[model samples]
Target chain A: MTSLLNALPGAVSQGLIWGIMAIGVYITFRVLDIADLTVDGSLATGGATCIMLIRAGLNPWVALLIAFAVGMIAGFVTGILHTKCGIPAILAGILTQLSLYSINLRIMESKANQPVSVDKYPLLVSSRHVGGFTLKNPIFLMIIIAIVLITVLYWFFGTEKGCSIRATGANSNMARAQGINTNSNKILGLMLSNGLVAVSGALLAQYQGSADVNMGRGAIVIGLAAVIIGEVIFGKIFKQFWLTLLAVVIGAVIYYVVLQLVLMMGLNTNDLKMLTAVIVAIFLAIPFWKNKIAGKRLGKKEASKDA
Target chain B: MLELINVNKTFNVGTANEKKALDNLSLTLNDEDFVTVIGGNGAGKSTMLNAIAGTFRIDSGSIILDGMNITSLPEHKRAAFLGRVFQDPQMGTAPSMMIEENMALAARRGQRRGLSWGISEAERTQYYELLKSFDLGLEDRMTTKVGILSGGQRQALTLLMATIKKPKFLLLDEHTAALDPKTAAKVLALSEEIVTREKLTTLMITHNMKDAIRYGNRLVMMDEGRIVLDISGEAKKKLTVAELLAKFSEASGHDETSDKMLLS
Candidate 1:
């Protein structure tokens, strides 16, 4: 109990960082209505690019920005494959993810793992300051970043072009009939989403003091878990856009806290992936099951009325 | 003004299911001309409207609108001058969007969308008044999602959306077919009011012969992917459903066997 209590802050800070990536996933999965698989690759690409640029003696913030741009480029390729080449969106994301594996390895100079020592380089956030009350505390910085991101996104989505994007996702036929260029809006959405994921990746690499090629494996599942958890817990109360985003971050913190409890319960580290998949599958099925049950109940009532 | 010259469209080409949907069809509409099109199933009625709306690339054709060649224009590009309402009420509006937001989208149709606020206070007030005019009690539910509305309400809203921007041309593909008899009559009346008030150039397709003979300045009958009968001026004004059926049979050179056409 003492050790778990001590590890709580670490889990919270890590959760906040992952929450940023979850928000990026939310953009595609909820807003754009696309199950994009690019995050699994783009997350690694962000970390690799940031670590390499910092090692090459660039400013850490500048490196993060460049990482975001690279992520956008990857999203752009997926968008082109889906829209211009007429490939299905899921296939397009898979193809980009497959190609990104080699690209990520190349970016790390053919190494599977690379480290950016906190002792040698300045970083936006570090696990070394996990429980600190100082300005270097990642939890505080991440909270600030999350709030700013939510505010910016809220304002953007209220704009005309942003509304057009929403309309496209809601109904592309109506969007086109109302003169919206749905293809362009879709591309723009993918780029924005991946850019945020990259920003989260850059922060994660800095926090961990390393970037590994396989660091982002199954990242999409984690992001989906965060989004689904958030909605299940907070969807009823948080009708406003910004509040909904905040709930997603809160869900990530809760997920990490639960995972820590599971580890303390003596679950094998090798089984964590299977556990995550199982939990996510259960969460995803809740809504479907509820709907089905309600439908059956309604049918029974109607049958009784007819009788 | 609109013109379609030698428009042709074939679906499922080079396959066992090959079907020629539109066959060398041509049409012309002058300023403020409301033309109601009637035809049996697979008579190229809807296909003609789709061609004019740029729903798909015609196999080979030229479409001219307001003195501009728009044959190659994409659907979104052509939407600048066209307002369309489909047979299904769900097809014309974004169901998840708020009623006011949907109106705002239609209000800015063909205009450059930017970083500006989506719905202005002034626009909201104007939309409220306009919606109130329908007397459907929709003005108070500006923020309600269109998904929750009834089919009749949606069709009425769609009619308003089609004319919200004063489109150069309006296309109605059985816009009220899904509604109940009373609601359909209400929507048809509303359609006639809007068309007359705006003097809009329109091409409306209908399964109802009486509706085709009642509304619009001109009437066109299609069969076998071709315009078999066209009546206008005095000839169209004095025409009844019986005369239309008789003329259809004579002009089409075949007996009227489809009861769906006569009954509708």
Candidate 2:
């Protein structure tokens, strides 16, 4: 119990960082109605770009910006493959992700892992300050970043171009009939989504003091977990767009906290992936099960009325 | 003005199930023509409208609209000059979007979309007044999602969306075929009101013989991917369902009319 309590701050900080990645997933999965698997590789791309740039004597902030741009390029490639080449969205994402594995390796100079020591480099946030009382605390920085991101997203979604993207997701036929270029809108959405995921990855690398090529493994599952957990808990309360995004962030925090508890209870780290998969599967099936039960009740009512 | 010259389309070409949907079909619509098209199943009525709308590229044709050659224009590009309503009520509007938002989308059909707010305060007031005029009480629920609306309400909203920007051409592909009798009648009346008021050059496809004879200044009949009968002016106004059937039979060399056509 003491160990778990002591780990809370680090867990929360990690959760907030991952929460940013979850927001990226939400844009593609919920808003764009696409299951984009590119995050698994794009996340690493962001971390690799940021770390490589920082090591090359660039400002950390500038590195983050460059990382975001590179992530967008990765997303653009996937978009072209899907929209221009007529590949299925899921397949397109997978192809980009598969290729990015080699690209990330090349970015790291064939290294499996690269360390960005906090003592040597000026990182924006770090786990070393997780329990710090000052503004340098990772939690504080992540909270501020989350707030800014949510505000910007809220404003953007109300714009004409944003509404067109939403319309494209809702009904492509109607969008085309209304003179919206659905293909371009989709490409824009994918780019925006991957850009955010990369930003999250950059932050994660800085916080952990290292960028491992495997850091983003199963990232899509984690992102989906965060999005689903947020919806399940705050779906009713967070009807507003900004609030919904906040829920996703909070969901990540809760996910990490719960994961900390599980680890403290003596669970093997290797089994964590299986546990996450089961939990996500159950949550995904919940709506279908609820509908089936409701349908059965309606059938019984109809039978009674006929009698 | 709209013109389709020597348009042709074939589905599943080279396969055993190959079918020619449009075959060297040609059509010309003068300014404010308001032509209604009728034909039996598999007759190229909807295909002709779709070809004009650029839903799919015609195998070979030259489409001229408003003095511009648009044969190679994409669907979204062509949509700038066209307003289309589908037979399925669900196909015409984004079900998850708010009523006002849907209208806002249609209002900027041909314009470049940017970072500006999607629905302006002034536009909201205008939309409110327009919705109030529909008598469907939609003004009170502008923020409601279109998904929860009844089929009739959706059709009405779709009609408003189609003409919200005063499109150069309005294409109705049996838009009211899915509605109930009373709602269908109401939508038909609304269509007439909007068309006459806007003076929109229009092509409307219908399965009902009565509706084909009743509405529009011009009437056209198609069979086997070809326009077999064309009537206009006083002749079209005086035409009856029986006369239409006789002409259809005579033109197509078929003694029997499909039950679906006759019953409707």
DockQ of each: 0.86, 0.87
Error of 2 at A239 (Å): 1.2
Docking quality class, candidate 1? high
- What are the runs in model 1 whose C-alpha is more than 4 Å off? B259-263
Per-residue C-alpha lDDT of model 1 across residues A201-236, encoded as one tens digit per residue? 888999999998998899999999999899999999
Proportion of true inter-chain contacts also present in candidate 2: 0.80
Residue A102 displacement in candidate 1 (angstroms):
1.0
Model 1: lDDT of residue B183: 97
For candidate 2, the chain B TM-score comes to 0.97
| Interface RMSD of every predicted model, in angstroms | 0.6, 0.5
- The weakest ten consecutive residues by lDDT in model 2 chain B span B255-264
